[model samples]
Structure formats: C-alpha cells, structure tokens
Target: MNLYSIAIQQLTRQHMATIEALVRQQPEFDRVEDLADRLRQAGVRAEARYVPAEKLFIAVYGDIAQVEAALETLCRLNRLNCVPGSSSWQLVHQDHSITQPAVLVIHL
Candidate 1:
C-alpha cells in the first residue's frame, strides 16, 4: 500500500478544532477515503490516520497525490487557509517507499 503523510500546523485552538471537526465529518473526507479504498480494493491496503499535537494535526494517507488533491480542494473550499506547496507547509516523499511522504502545513 502507498502511504502519504500530511501535517497541518495548529496555530490556535480554533484551527485545530476546525481540522478535528473536518476529520470527523465523513463527507469532508469522502474523496480521500474513497481514493484510499479504491487502492485497497486493488490490493493496496490503503489507510489514513490523524496525529494531533499542541500545534499540529498530521494526516497520514495512502496516496500522496490523492491527499495533495484533497488538501488542495479543502483550500479551494475555504476549509483550509494555505496551498499544498505553499511556504506554510513542506512536502517530502519517500524515495524507496510510500510509507513516508511528509506534508507539513504551518498555520497562519
């Protein structure tokens, strides 16, 4: 299975809460989950999880492209405040495996 890690900074409780709420809302995550499920159905065994911290919320997904797309969509929808490749976040993909694509979003 391919793995992609997406990290978003939580500059404030409000931003963190917003991100947490969005994660719980199934519809908000539908496209991403669907993409992961599709990969799993194809024998990829995809999964996604969120790691919360005092100043960050990291979302680990199965596909880098899909996760990137989803985050970009969120930005477009005004759900998020930054772009995928903006200075606010740093994205790194694993060279040997899909297990470690790190995406960091710095909260403004």
Candidate 2:
C-alpha cells in the first residue's frame, strides 16, 4: 500500500478520527475564518475552533504532510512559526519573547 493508505490503516487501527493542532494565540474571528478557508483551498479538510478564553484548536483530516505544508505557508505569510510533530502541529508567534504553551496531541 502507498503512504496515504498506510496512514489511514494506522489511524483506523488506533480508532483515530482526526489529527489536531494547537495555535498558541487566540485569534480574532476573522482570522479563524481565514485559516479555515485557506486550509480548504489547499485541499485539506480542516476546521478551526476558538472558544472564548481558550487556545485555538485546529483539526485536520487527510494527509498530514499536505496539512503541514499548507499550515507552514499560512504561518509564513502571517509571520507565525509552524512547528510540526508526528500527529500534531503548533503555531507560534515569530517573536521569541512570547512563550509558546506546551502542546499535547491527544489521539482519539
């Protein structure tokens, strides 16, 4: 099987639905909408959620590499930093003074 098929099988074996990412900043409503739109445009199924007083949560469905590349492009354009993990992504501010929160990727 190809990589995508293998990935799907692995996720299925683990009973995982989606891979999630965390953005350290709580962005404005417009920014959140823009993020979701951009991901969709890149052909990745994605959703961004921002609850009041909580960090921004991004859930991506499909190829992880594609999602990460899309995220990196978006972050570069927005002057943010994109850090990717095995099954999660983290978006941080470019400015080093701002500390990034600890990231946890929960598989469900």
Candidate 3:
C-alpha cells in the first residue's frame, strides 16, 4: 500500500473513547487552531468545530484552490487521511465508529 493508504489504515484503529472525550471537553477548538490559522493566513474566512457527535467539521469560504491547498497542508502536517470530494473533503477517522465522521466543506 502507498503511504496515503497506510495512514488511512492506521487511523482506522483510533479508539473511539478519545473522540468521545474530545466532544465533551471541546478541546478540538484548540486542536484545530493551526488549520484555522493557515486558512486565515490565506485570506479565507474559516471556522473549525467539533460536533457533539464526535465529528470534526471545518468550513471555509474563499477561493477554492486556496482553500484546498490550505486543507492539504493541514492534512499533511497532521497526518490526517483525507479524500477529496466534489464539495468537501471526507476526513477518514476510525472506521469502527459511526460518530466520528470528519468533514471539511468548502464554500465559494
């Protein structure tokens, strides 16, 4: 498997308990600051949130290319497994859980 696939497989084993803890404490607000900072530096209007269901959601309004690049950088640095979609990027986390769906939506 390629490096990307390897990373995806690795996260599939992440314990859901950690995700649940994040949702309760809302620590993802601090955790995603780097991503938000990168988007803002690229002149994009962005916000990052951790849903109560243990999902990570990042919304960006700006040039599509810039938004995509920023997200790419974030994923690379954070070792996140993200698959690009038509209107958003599906961030694959643990596959064993239904509540940890991480998604990044781009707005023009």
Can you give the TM-score per candidate against the true fold?
0.29, 0.53, 0.52
TM-score of 1: 0.29
What does the lDDT read for residue 26 in candidate 1? 57
lDDT per residue for candidate 2 within 1-108, as digits (tens), equals 799999989988665432222332334444656667787888878776655465556667887677777887888886777776778766667888865543322111
Q: TM-score for candidate 2, please give it.
A: 0.53
Model 3 spans > 4 angstroms off: 1-25, 49-56, 93-101
Checking candidate 2 for backbone clashes, the offending pairs are none
For residues 36-95, write the lDDT of model 3, one tens digit per residue.
676687677888765658456677786788777876776676566768888777655534
lDDT of 3: 0.66
Candidate rank order under lDDT: 3, 2, 1
Q: Which ten contiguous residues of candidate 3 have the minimum total lDDT?
A: 92-101
- Once superposed on the true structure, which residue ranges of model 1 sit more than 4 Å away at CA? 1-26, 53-108
Off by over 4 Å in 2: 1-29, 50-55, 96-108
Q: In terms of lDDT, which candidate is stronger, 2 or 3?
A: 3
Error of 3 at 95 (Å): 12
Assess candidate 1 and give its lDDT: 0.44
**Per-residue lDDT of candidate 1, residues 1-108 (tens digit):** 223222223346668887788676655345445434544444433454344453223334355655555555544543333334432344343243544324344322
